[model samples]
Target: MSKTVTFVILLLLVIKTSVVCRAQCSQGAIICETFGSGPRGLLPQGITNFTYRARACPDDGEYTLLDTVSGDCHGQAWHPILEDHTPNDVRGNMFVVNASYQPSEFYSQKVAGLCPGVIYEFSLWALNLNRILTAGACDEYILRNPIIAMRIEQPDGTLIKEIIQPAITRTATPIWVSLSMQFSIPTSSNDIVVKLVNKGLGGCGNDLVIDDIGFRPVHPGLSIQFSNSPDAETTVCADTRLSLTVGTATGYISPAYLWQQSQDNVTWTAIPNATLSTYAINPVRPGRTYYRLRNTQSINASAVGRAQCSAESNVLVVNGLPDSPFSLGPDQVLCEGTTQAIPAPTSLPAGTTFVWSDQSKSQNLTVSLAGTYWLETNFNGCTYRDSVIVESQNCRLDDIYVPDAFTPNNDTHNDQLVVFHAGAFLTYSFRVFDRWGNLIFVSRQIDVSWDGTFLNRPCSDGIYAWTADYSVLNPLNQTHHFVRSGRVMLVR
Candidate 1:
C-alpha cells in the first residue's frame, strides 16, 4: 500500500478508539459522549448520528460533524475564525449545526439505563462559529447571534419537558460554553430523549458546535451527625484521652472525611492525618479546644460534578482544667455587719462541683462575719482549693467641732474656717453665708476648709453665718443625722 493510504488507515483507527472511549461513562456517571466517531451516517467523519430528527436541513442533515482544525463545507481553514483554542473540547471533534439552513435543526439521542424516579443532570459544551464562511455575498442575510435549546422527551416522540429553552448565547470567539439542567425521571418512562438545537438563523454567523455531553445521578442532600466520648463540654485533666465520633444518617456513595480543630473556637484548621469517621486526641492541652468533622464528595454529577458537596458536623468542646483551682480574687475587707459574697471561678470545667469552706456545696459563699473563706472545686476524680481573706472595720462618731473664728492675715495659723472630728460621720455638708443670707462657701468633704475669699478675692472681715448637716453610723449600723448652726468671724 502507498504511504498516503497507510496514513489514512491509521487516522481512521485512531478516531475509532477515541469515539469508543468518549462514549463510555466516567466512574459514578451514567452516560457520556464526546461525538468523536468517524464519518458513518448522514454526518461526515468525526460526528455521531442523532436518534431522531424534527426540522429539515437545506444543504445537509440536522447536524454535521466537524473538527476544530477543519474549515467550513468549502474546505477553508478555520484558524482565523477562532480566537484561542477551545478549552472545553477535551476531544478535538464536535458536532455542528446551522439554523438558517432550515427553520431549525437539532441533534438528539435516547438515553437509556437510568434509575427510575431518580434525579439526573444533563450537560454539554457549545461554541459559536462567529467567522463568516463567505464574503459580503451572504453577510447581510447571516445572523451571527445564536441560542441553543435543550429538551427532554418521551420515547414516543412527545415532549416531556423543556430542560433549557433558547437561553444560552454564543460568543464571538470559538470558546466552548457549558450548559446544564437537572430533572427527575418519570416512573413509567424507561428511557428519555435529549435534544440539542441551534436556534440562530445561519446565513453568516449562526454556526455552533457542541461536545462533551454527559449525564449522571447524584444525591440531593448531605447531613452529618457527631458524637463525643465524654459528651460535649466535658472537663478533663491534662494528658487525658478524648475520642470524637462522626457519622452520616444518609450514607452517600464514597464520601470523604476530614477532622478539624480550633483553639479560639472561631477559626478552624484541619487536623493532620485525621481523615476518618473517628478521631482520637491524647494528652490534651491545658486549655479549651473545639473539634468538628467535615464530609465532602462529588455530587450533582454532570459537567459540574466536581462542584463542592460538603457538610460539617456540630462542634464539641473539651476543657482541660489546671491541677489547682485558680483564685477568683485577692483578700478583701468589708465593713462590720456588712455582708460580702465571694464569687467562684468562671473557668471551672464542666462536670465540676464546688464546695465552700463552711461545708456548703454552693458555688459562692456569703458571710456577714469577718474571717477567711475558701472554695474547693472537684473534677475528674481530683480536688483543688483556693482561699480568700475578709476583714471588718468598727467605725464610731463621738462629736463634731467647727471653728467659729479665723485669721486670714497671710499667717498659716487660723488662716481659714474649718471643721474637726468630721471623719467620724458617714456623710456631712457645711455651708457658710454672708449676713445678707447669700451663700459664700459650701463643701461636702469632711476635711474641706474655706479661706476668707470669694472667687479668689479676699472678702471683708465680718461674721458669716454657717450651717452644718452630718450623719453617723450608729451601733445598729443605721444612719443618725444632726444639724448645727454657728457664726464664724473672718478677720483678714
Candidate 2:
C-alpha cells in the first residue's frame, strides 16, 4: 500500500582481490562449473579467483556472491521474480561496466525475420575485472574499453539486437550502477547467442558472467504495484492458501519475501512452510484470524538498508466444516414431541442399537423430546455417534389426517373438507375437489390453507372429496418414513 526505495552495494568494485567460492544447486544436490583464473580450464592460463558460493543461506538452500574483504557486497542472495523488467544483481554474477571503442554487428546476432526486443541490465564491481575474464589492454581481440557485448536471439534462430555495456563497478565502488538496453529480436525460432560470434565474442572474451535472467512482460511507470486481499479471518478447517501480487518499477530489485501468521496479531508465528507470494493457512481456532508479510527485501531499497515490510492481506474469517459426523449417523431435524422411532441402520445388517433421552439401546425408541442428541453404535469397521437436533412442535398436532366425504349441495355445516390429527406426525399434506371434481384447494406442512374455493372463487354448496398424506418412522432407527394416504370430506 505504501512505497520506499533502498540501495545496496551488492555489486562491489574490488580490484585484484583473492576471492574463491563453490556454486551448486540448492542442497549442494548438483554441482556445476565456476568462472575465473587458476586451476580449472583447457587454456594454459587456467580459470580461478571467482567461486560459486552457497553464501549465508547454505542451509536454507540459496547461494549468492561472497567478497573476501569487508566490502559493501556482503550479504545473503536474493532472486526476486519480476514482471516487465530484468533483475538487479542476479545474485552471484559480477556487475562490471567495461566500455568499447565502437558498435559492430560482429558481436550482434543477425536478425532473421521479425525480432522481439530484449532489455539487458548488468552491473560490474570495478575491482574484480582482470581476475575473471582472460583479456586485457594488450590483448588485440579484447577492446581497450571495459564494456562487453552479448547477443540474445529469438526462438526462431535469428539475430535479435546486440546489447553492449561496460563491466559493473569498474572504479565506482559502493555505487550501484546499471546498464539497461532493449535489443529488437530476430523473427526466427532460435534466440540470438550471448556467448560466441565471428569477432572475439563482440569484446566479451572470456568473462561476462550472469545469474538471474528474467524473461517477462514490461510494465511502465506507476503501474508497478503489489496487492494482498481480504486482510484476515478465522477458519474452521485446518488448511488454507492465501494469494499475493506485488508491483514493481524498473521491474523488481533485490526483493526478498517472508510470511508470518499468528493467533494473536500481537505476536506472529513465522510459518516456515507458508512462503513466497502466498501463505498457506493452517490449523487454527474456528473464529478470527491474522497474517502479515515481512519484507526481508524490497524492490526499491538500498542494498545495505532494511525496512519494515507492509502489513499482510486484510483479515479473512474462515468457518471450517465438520470432517467427520459427530455420532455415526447423518444429521436431520425432527418435529418436537414427534415420536420418530429409530430404525436400526440397514447398512449394519448385523443389526444396531440406539441411545437417546431414554435408557434402552433398543432397536426402536420414541423421540419424546427436542434437542441435539448423539447416537453411539459399532458398525462395519468403525463406530458412529450421530449428532442431530429435534425441533419443538409449533402445535400439539404435528400434522393433520383427513377422511373422505363432504357434501357441497347447499349444506351450510358440511360444505368444507377439513384435516384433523393427534400430536405425532411432523408434517401434513392435503388436496380437495368439487362434486364436478375440479381441484379447488390444497395445503402442505404448516405454511398455507384453503377455504373451499376454485380459481379464487367460492364453490357452490355441494359434496366435495379430498386426499391427505403424512409420515411416520419405524420407531427404532429414525429412518425415513414410507408414504401413508387417506381421504377427507369438504363441508361448509
Candidate 3:
C-alpha cells in the first residue's frame, strides 16, 4: 500500500466513525445518535447510502432530518408524526427514510473507544411512518411492512452480531417502538461498525422514521430507598442517623459498590469504608443532604464513581432540622371562674406538631382549673415537651339583698316580700315569724316570697322577723355558709 493510499483509507475510516455521538441516555447510558437538533441539514458524506434532502418529505431512496412530520402523502396514506422519539426534546431531529426499489444498506457508522470484555447494548427508536388501507382487507395487512437488518462488524470487517428486526407494521395511530440487542466487546476488538440495511423494497409503503440511536453498557438498575421509610425523601431532627438500602441488582459477575454523599445533589463525595448494598448514615448536621450508591465491576475500581462506567442509584434526600428554640412561659396563676389562653409554639419546622395534656391540637390551651398542663411536640421522629403549673386564688365575694318593707294591698306594687342574692349561692333557706315567735311563713326555696297572709287569712300588718341560712362559693371554689336575721313591716 502506498503512503497516499493508506492516508485515503484512514480518511474514509474517520468519516465512518464521525457520526458516532456521545449524547445523553437513560441512567447514564450512552446515546450514540439523536439525529442532532431541529433544522439539521444532512449527514456527512458516506454516512448513509440514501441521498439527503433539505425538505421535510423524502422520496424513494432518499432520507431527511425533521423535527415534526405533517401533511398528506400518497393520497394521505401516511400517518403524521407530531414529535420525535427523543424524550424531553421539544424540537429534536429524527431520521425519516423511504426505502429504495431494492434491498440495500441505508445507514452505517463505526463506534470506537469501547471497553473490551464489557456488555454493551445497541438500540434505536423506530416508527412505521405509513398508514395504508387495503380495500376490504382484515387486520390492516395491505401494505408492505418495513424490515431492517442490524449488522455489527469489527474494524477489520469481521462480522460479530446480526439481528433481523421484525417488520414494523402499520397501526391505527403512529407509534414509536424500541428495538435493542446486547453484545460483549471481544478482547481482540474495541471498535465496531454498525450498519442498518433495508430488508424490504420500497413501493406503496416500507417507510419509517428513526431516532435516539444508542450504544451503551448494559448495567443493572440501582434504586436507593430508606430502610425504615416508604418514601425516598424525608425530614429528620438535627444530629439524626439514617439507614439506606439499594434494590438488588443483577448482571455483574463481581459487583463492587461505593456509598456517596452530597450537600446538594450536583456534587458528591465518596464515604470511606462504605462499600455495600446497604449503608448507614451517621448523625447528619443541620441542612439538606443527599445519598446514592455507585456500582461497577470489582476490577474497575477507578471507574466506581464515573457515571459512564458505573450504575448510580436513585438519589435519597434528607432534610435535617435544627434544634428547636421555644418556651411555654413560666408557671401561671388563674382564678377558678376565669380562663387564660396559653400561646402556641412558633418558628418550628414545617412538619412539627404539638398536643396538650388534654389531647387538644388547638392553637392555644384554655385553662381554668389549677393543675399541671403540658405540651408535647413531635418532629421528625423525635418528641419535645414543656409544661406550666396553674394555681387558683379567691378574688371576689358573693352578695345578698333583702327587702325592708312591703304592703299586701293587692295593688301589684310592694304586695309581697322577696329575697335576692348574687348567683354564687350554693344552698339557701328562709323563715318568717311574728313578734309572738310563731312561725307564720317558712320556706326553703330561694325565689319564694311572703304575702303577709297565713292559711288564706290576713295577718295584723306589723313588723315581721325573718331568718335565713345560705352557702355561697367564692372565686377560689370554696363554699362559705352564713346565718342572718332581719325585720320587715307589712301593711294591708
**Candidate whose TM-score is highest:** 3
| Deviating ranges (above 4 Å) for candidate 2 | 1-33, 36-147, 153-161, 166-328, 332-387, 391-400, 403-488
201 Cα displacement, candidate 1 (Å): 4.0
Order candidates by lDDT, high to low. Answer: 3, 1, 2
lDDT of every predicted structure (CA atoms): 0.58, 0.36, 0.73
lDDT tens per residue, model 1, 248-342: 42544565667778999867787888877788777666789888766644232221212222345667887876554578588887766578788
- Summarize candidate 3's per-residue lDDT along 46-135 as a digit string, tens digits: 776667777766777677788887647545656888888877777888788766766766566776655455667777778888775656
Candidate 3 all-Cα RMSD: 24.5
Per-prediction CA RMSD (Å): 20.4, 16.7, 24.5
lDDT of 2 by residue, 1-492 (tens): 000110112211221122222332111111111223222212111111122234422111112233221222212112221211112213233322121223333222222221122222222212322222233433564322234445555545444555655444322222223333444333233133332221222232222223222112122221111134333333343332334333332323444445555666655566575445544454433445555554322432221111111212333344443232233345445665466765544454353444544556765555766666556654333344555666655353324455466665445655545555544455556667666777777788533545667786766655666666666443453534334454454445
Ranking of all predicted structures according to TM-score, beginning with the best and ending with the worst: 3, 1, 2
Predicted structure with the largest lDDT when compared to the true one: 3
Candidate 1: minimum summed lDDT over ten consecutive residues — where? 1-10
